[model samples]
Target: MFMKWKFFDKIPVEGGVSYQDLAASVGAQGEIVSRMGQMLVSTGTLLQPKPGSVAHSRLSLRYKTGNSNGSAFAMLYDDFQPVFAKLPGFFGKYGPNLPVGKTNIPITFASGADGKLTPWEVFAQQGTEHIEQFGLAMQAMTGYLWPHTGAYDFTWVGKYAATNPNRTLIIDVGGSFGHSLRANLVKYPNIPPGRCAVEDREEMIPSITKAHANDPVMENVQKVAADFHKEQPVKGALIYFIRRCLHDYDDNDCVNILKILADSLPEDEPQARVLINEHIMTDPPDREVAAIDIIMMTWASLERTVQQLEKLADRAGLVVIKVHRAGGSSLGVLECKKASRS
Candidate 1:
């Protein structure tokens, strides 16, 4: 409400916009606006400069319309409100355990489509608007929730790519619009774009094609419209990079996805890697990780720890080579290789 009316930018540090002026500017009832403003004030997001006036608190100032990332918070709230409200009922009807099936999760349960559609299908029904917001929200997330800075020293892939330019260096499974791959290319220019690929659903190919035109580095990236659950068509790739994907499915499904990548590794190259980039849910996890675990439950998934990740890789016939993570960071890159090939 405040953002739409530019209250954060309009209100000065010493003074504030009166309730009458703010309400009139936005064609809303003054009393209703005042009530809504009060809710924000209680949260330290807004300031009640006077009995009938409101101003931007230090926190609120950061939410100005110019800050595109703030839209992520709004999008999540708007899209997940119904699902969040139905969590208790979903557990009651489907049992208290974490949802087990893709088609019967909290999202599907909330929409009364339980056992009928996956969360993605439910979102598809809503058309592209929600998905567009979701994309932006994800972009915003990359800024903080999953900072790519020093995440895994992706620069090494550049040298790895130069070793055999014709051999595929990376296949980013389930990478949406190739944004992650594009960022990596920018960071590590030596990583030949033609040697890397990004696989996603067929419907997303047009967008990926459009996105590729936006950045020259992405021009040579091979965009493959393939499902990760099925056979991996690109064989013998040096690196199969799957980020924030395994945590989206159950253990059985995660194992299958890993196995597909494991199978794609060349027998001669024991050093071939499968990089899993995800958050490690700790014992008595920090508030952030714990909160994310519950949120992911809405989609019938949970974050995994290092030990849990190792077990998943082992089940997929792969061995965890090492965990690359900076101190005080729960997000890590679990580097793995095919056990049989090793």
Candidate 2:
């Protein structure tokens, strides 16, 4: 059910279906394919041709690696066109309001969970297989969310940290390979060593450390093998950062992860902030944001809207103090604070 609409990139030699037609046959609305298709085209990542005639419209979109049937978008289109031609009323039958090939509806992962697989447990169990697919998904996602730098409102954060470079602690929790750190470092020269730290899985430390060996500012940048879901290592860092990490799990998982994060901080810091980098879906349903919601659903994750994120923060014993829309899209820079004891 989940795989029915996963984007496929290749053409089938024999299926005789086109991507567009398959999209039509499955009762998928034009907006879904158009949005996803336009995204691929906009990034110059891939090209897709709309079939000239209904006869040549059907295609197969084989999403997986070993699919013997027509799987590519082109193939999917080929497969789709014929079905539509044969049954002229398919589009009218399902219509845009119905769920034709909608990807995420939450029911999918629950089925897996019924089999006793928690989301991350599923990831940990599948290990490399899941990671590889997830990584590819991330790559495609990054492209769609172009100008990724704008996603975090890093400019504002850097400017603020620059005011007290020596005292500020910029900890990128779950920061993978120091990429975001470097991005911030390059933008904000006022920040210095011992100020920024990156914490991630133990397995990633060596390579990340080696990569930063020559970085003078990062020399004091502590890199630790830590889990944000269990506990944070630092006492009361000025900022605890998480980028694209929370959306990988369900609501309960996020609550537990945030609880661990909140507990790790000290009670008496002048100011402590928890920054989450993620997309906050639009309420009325924008094409791109809705598309990602489906993707997250398939991966056993959720991308909350601004109100929902704030609510999640409150549940975790923190308050959403501020939100910076660095770009118009779903991504936002959320700053949270511990509930005031007073």
TM-score of each: 0.82, 0.59
Per-residue lDDT of model 1, residues 111-207, tens digit only:
8999999887887787665565555556565655676545777777777666666689889888876777878778888888888898987767777
- Tens digit per residue, CA lDDT, model 2, 72-157: 23232432233334332433443433222222222223333323554444444545434333333343334346234564444555
The TM-score measured for candidate 2 stands at 0.59
lDDT of 1 at 142: 66
Candidate 2's C-alpha runs over 4 A off are 1-148, 151-168, 213-220
Please tell me which predicted candidate would have the highest TM-score against the true structure: 1
Off by over 4 Å in 1: 1-68
